[model samples]
Target chain A: MYKHTTDGLRTLLNIPDNYQIFFLSSATEIWERIIQNCVEHTSFHCVNGSFSKRFYEFSGELGKKAFKEEAAFGKGFYPEKFEIPAETEAICLTQNETSSGVSMPVADINKIREKNKEALLFVDAVSSLPYPEFDFTKIDSTFFSVQKCFGLPAGLGVWILNDRVIEKAKQLEAKKVLTGTYHTISSILSKAKDNQTPETPNVWNIFLLGKVIEDMNKKGIATIRKETEVKADMLYNYIKDSNNFSFGVEDPAHRSKTTIVANTAIPAPEVNKKLEQFDLAVGSGYSSYKEKQIRIANFPAYSVEKTEELVNALKKTIG
Target chain B: MYKHTTDGLRTLLNIPDNYQIFFLSSATEIWERIIQNCVEHTSFHCVNGSFSKRFYEFSGELGKKAFKEEAAFGKGFYPEKFEIPAETEAICLTQNETSSGVSMPVADINKIREKNKEALLFVDAVSSLPYPEFDFTKIDSTFFSVQKCFGLPAGLGVWILNDRVIEKAKQLEAKKVLTGTYHTISSILSKAKDNQTPETPNVWNIFLLGKVIEDMNKKGIATIRKETEVKADMLYNYIKDSNNFSFGVEDPAHRSKTTIVANTAIPAPEVNKKLEQFDLAVGSGYSSYKEKQIRIANFPAYSVEKTEELVNALKKTIG
Candidate 1:
């Protein structure tokens, strides 16, 4: 948690001393804090998946006006297509949509940043940060959870901020700040800087994450990414050749290498139930495609043997 | 997550359907949600420890006028000491102060309820809910986290609300309700009733907690409390006879059986550093007493063997 919250930002993102960062117990807490803190001006939501859509909904509940540019799930929004309103103060995007198995390219984000210099850019990189090529220099604020790619338990969220976002947060704090026992970002930032947490943190998980990050650095992030890509490719190839299965997202370029989302002709719930009987648990589709799709994650820690077992189980269950 | 979010309140707190309830992610979230949703007139905070003090701070930040009945950190507030202000909309109290190892008796809350029927009573039971003696019938809202006596990892918070609190929430939702991705009480409650979560929850920890709760039910809450008391007694007995050790909170009746807060004649940070060598990690003092105090928790699942090992290590370090 220490490395991800502090030095990790310095190394991965060119986080300057002027920028202030805060940690939340979860990425979802980030959205709650954003609504409570930064909801004065209109926020623009460029959504392609469930998580981003949820954020747009959250902004509305806070009585904040929002301009939304949403594509079909698993499709990315081109930067040129985004029409930001004059009142837009923030642009929110999910760098990678884990549930749909798609990611927005860096070029797209750069284009958006070039267009909206005044609007703060916020990215949800929960499932993409450590394994994928993510440069924090492009966004104003980015948030990631420890559980997804960091190989740590789900409890803590690491949020990185640029100087502009920090300025915005300071302005918000001066207003109607809702300081709670565990949800105070200002309190969390003070403790996080000291390698501590405001409330009783998941100390065991934080200890383990430090070890995981150390191990990752030793192994090299490039090597880990390469291995993950190969694992994802192997599964994608199998799905392509299979007569009964098809990829959920139409565009190959938009598909996520970390999570493989597939559509089966059969009902997803039935297939999921059958897969579970074989002791193989696959993610059932969420939202619109709930009954029609299933997601298989090829995270960094998933060994080749386990991947093979899952493939074998899939073959047997589908057959 | 399912049992607690759905049936835990009904089963554990015996909350009738006639008494509406709401679910929040954490106790802190509840405070903010209450301010955003239920603040009307003014709130009264019984400030005796960190949790209650934090609530008073929250009200101040929200720009809501609140009255604080100040008591020392280790003592409970006498409900009859002050007349409830006619403008007071709610009365908040921390059932147990984890930092001070102090718990307020339920009868004290009942006394407040009798005196101020117009003011809704809120309890921060983060450290005391799971104890066998915690009766839920007297308060309007009670919240706790899974990490404390629940023996579950931290991420999710457990909360119970009476009809009055629920009615207040409903009234606010009818007005301008604050929406949250993970911290929204409405989202958690809606999904919880169906054994689901608003967003992706900490599945592994939630699964572990289900198992732990099942084990607790089998063991019985009364038996669990009795065992914890015995464990506290054994550790406190050792502390009482030790030459260099002393209880931080002087009041015997107010001391927490779950968390034994002790102040050593020696500097705390120095003694804590020494204790780390034995792999016995105890909590450090918060705020003003950071240099002189340490907190030892004897919650459920923390074995007697472990406590004995900690005691031996403490003796050796002090000697």
Candidate 2:
């Protein structure tokens, strides 16, 4: 099941043959574990939104020399403007920022490889996957929690890393640095060789993931991506033309295809209540914006017709 | 659901009102986190078997001064012989050695308090709880995984700690020591105040744990404990009187009431195969003894009548 799921996801995301996949408890835990295994001293992050910013804080908390080039919330980072320190060991990028619905283009991720040829490039594809058409060869690692795109319950996170990431961990372990207590890169790699985890994993979720990905495989990744794109467009176009609502990310290219954030003129809770009356549920703005913005998840599972119903419901309530 | 489960377990286990319960990913992960959050310098482990030795190794992995007083496999630690260093920040104990089926009596745990007044007492009740009637006042912390006694799918771990454990973490944090990155005692406490976990947790498993514990509550803990004792005695007596089998632990007092291990003249796999033929399954011995011994789990979920069937099958097959 583990291998089948990895193979299916690799084929779905265009991941190369050499990249290794590891299962973790959650994406939040991966923030610290990635720093422990992959980073030696400095970690440079491209923080455009809340989720990316939280990852940045995790590096600092772990006593790493952490630096970040920030963009405004709901804005994506431009690769050309990123002035990462040459001494940085890892360059962290959130491919899609779920909190604010901003996403980096595949081109920007590839450009990072050209700029920082030495540093390991890690991407957080938490909200946007199977939709991003990511060229995994250009990135050292990419990870996501299954709940977002795979439409599974929370608890399992998928971490992908290249051989280079493993080698770096080997170097650090040889240097007698505290890479981690358990779930170190070496332990993870050794366990994966046996199709096992160092600890008792979320076996149920892993099984479900394999089955879901196989089902997705039969349906094909291209079809899911195309449908996701159409649904995202429908939602974005509706927000664009509405007087009472506006797209969170002003630049359309930077908008996430999975999580679509909309700034509402009315209180977000009132909007949520109105939508609930129609039995259409959308997420409230995260953190402080809980009453200020409406966040809608437009994943592969949310069909085009259902998204259209949401748009229609919003049109009636907001207008 | 978490609160309901915790409440049920506390009532069943005789846990006090002030002790806090926090959920983690696995019992294995708890080994490292316990050292990180509670231990500042030295940790002394009463290593009678594999699991306790693994916890000792975890302390060493995190650059701590780790010391262990060893006992032979399937033997319990004698507190009178323990010469623990006064500077030890924590004393680790495995209440039940899952690998060897040996349990540290609650009396010995109280004796440790007499010797080490300063060090926090940490107990790994992974395979023993809500069966072990632990006195929470004597121990600073204890943890268990739901897959053991609760008979749930593996994923969630429950860490029970007292106020002193929190104070120790705060002291370490104030001293600028590396307590942890995320899921630190401070972080877990802060989030748990809001009745939430620090990250996205195993929601489904937690729900299952709550439901299972409620069912156990309806049946009552006293009746469960009495049944477990009777089943354990039945199995032990069967091994002792049999020509082909004998108890793994030499001292009857040290034997685990939950996991019962028996050395068999026949290969462990053969024993397992014979049991499988009866439409019953038993675990082979762990690791090195995999071919030499049989391990049987006598958890709360295993009914007395079912246990009797297993004993009867063993009687006919071994003879």
Candidate 3:
């Protein structure tokens, strides 16, 4: 399962041979490990919405000197200047903000690297993986939980980091800094060389992920990504043309292609109740926007036909 | 699933309302979280075997002043004096040493309580839960992974800690110590109060755990414990009487009723191969004892008839 899944993921995601993939319990745990293993004291975060802000909070809780540049909610982060401290060890960027339905283009990663060549560039591609068309070589690492884009059950988080991350971890361990307990990069990498995890991992999920990826490989990632784009476009066009709702992200270019959140004239809960009458359900706005926004997921599993049905349901509910 | 499982677990394990259960990925992760959240600077570990020693190592990696008193492998720890440091914030004890099959009696918990009045008492009941007849009130916390006594698949660890543990974590937080990252005790408790987890947990396993606990509740833990004892007695008596094998633990009182490890004159691999002819499989000895010992699990799920079959297979293999 390990060899097959690693191979499948590499082929599906266009991951390079230099990059290494390790599976953890969740993307949240990856945030903890990233700070512990890669960052020594300070790291810079570009926060567009909730998940990016949560990563900043995680670094702070781990006793790191966490600095952040924040964009307004429901907006994308555009770095005018990489005005980060020279001693910063890493820079965190969110490719797709699930909470606010905004995404930063892959070009933003190159810009960060242009300013700071040494600091590791980390991306939270939680809701955008396999569909983002990311230039993986530009970033040092990226992570995602399976429940989002893969349409699998939660419990497994896939973390892809390069050899530079390993070097940084070894440097910290040599200097007697606390990387972590068992799941530290040095410990995991040592065991991973044997195609194994550090502890008794979620083996069942790993097996299932392998099977899913095998199926995805048969269908071809290009076909999957194209279908996802069409479904996302259909849903987005409906919301844009509707008078009763408006897109959450003001710029069409900045709006997330995976998770589409919209501001509705009716209360979000009320709109959800109307959709429920059609045997359709969608998530309410994240956190504070719960009352005013509705979130729709255009994942790979959501077929073009099903998405069109959902669009029709939304139009009838709004009317 | 949380409410049903919590209720069913409380009934099956005789847990009081004050003892809270938070689920993590594995027992290894629990060791990391326990030391991070419950211990501030110093802690005492009573190490009998490999698993207990691992817990002590975890504390050290997290930068705690970890002190340890060790017993020989396959021997139980008996504290003659409470020689632990006064500043120690937590005391770690392993209820059953899974690697060596030595268990500390429940009565010994009172002896430590008598010495240390304020420190949090944490127990690793990884292979001896819902059948150990533990007086939960005597210890502040105990944790177990479902793959052991619960007879479920791996990946879910249930931690039962009381308010005292929570208070200790809050004190560490107030002092600006790193309690942990996202799954810290305080963060988990805050979410558990709302019957939730901090992140997308392994929801399928949680659902299965609830169903398994409901079945156990119906079977009654007492009946299950009785069967386990019977199985352990059968296996232990066979080892003692057979010329080819002997009990691993020196004293019968210290022998674990859940996992029975026996020293064998024949190489353990040969014994396993012989048993395989009967279509029976047993675990190889852990770590260094791999070739010299055979470990048998006396979990509740191994019914009386199944244990009898295994015993008969062992008799034939020895003959």
Predicted model with the maximum TM-score: 2
- In the order shown, the candidates' DockQ scores are 0.36, 0.82, 0.78
Reference-based TM-score of each model: 0.84, 0.98, 0.97
Off by over 4 Å in 3: none
Cα lDDT of model 3 by residue, B1-319, tens digit: 8878888988998898888999899999999999888887999999878999999999999999999988889888776654778888999999999999999888887788777888889989999987787787688999999898888777788999998998888988999888877898988988998889998888878888899898888898889888888898898888888988898999887899999999889999899889888888877788999978889988888888998998888887784
iRMSD, model 1, in Å: 3.5
Model 3 achieves a DockQ score of 0.78
lDDT of 2 at B223: 92
Task: Give the range where candidate 1 chain A is weakest over 10 consecutive residues by summed lDDT.
Answer: A176-185
lDDT by residue for model 1 (B1-319), tens: 5665445445555566755444344567677666655665588888887778887877766667889888887676666687778788888888788867777777777888878877778888787767635445567777777788887656566566766776776675666644234545566567756777665555565666667767777777777777888889888888798887787767776677887888877777788788889987778786787777778878887877788888889888875
Error of 2 at A129 (Å): 1.5
lDDT of each: 0.72, 0.88, 0.87
Residue range A1-319, candidate 1, lDDT tens digits: 6555366545534456655666566788787666556557578897778888888877777667888998988677777766888678888888888768877777788788888888888888888777656455667787888888877767667677766765666676776544233455566666766876666555555566667666777777777788888778878887897766798877877777777888878877787787787777777787777778888877877877778888877788784
Question: How many collisions per candidate?
Answer: 1, 0, 0
lDDT of 1 at A174: 74
Candidate 1 — which residues are off by over 4 angstroms? A1-22, A151-153, A175-185, A232-242, A269-282, A303-319, B4-26, B151-154, B177-182, B226-286, B291-319
What is the alpha-carbon lDDT for the whole of candidate 1?
0.72
Error of 1 at B124 (Å): 1.7
Residue A64 of model 3 has an lDDT of 91
Quick one: best lDDT, which candidate?
Answer: 2
TM-score for the first chain of model 3? 0.97
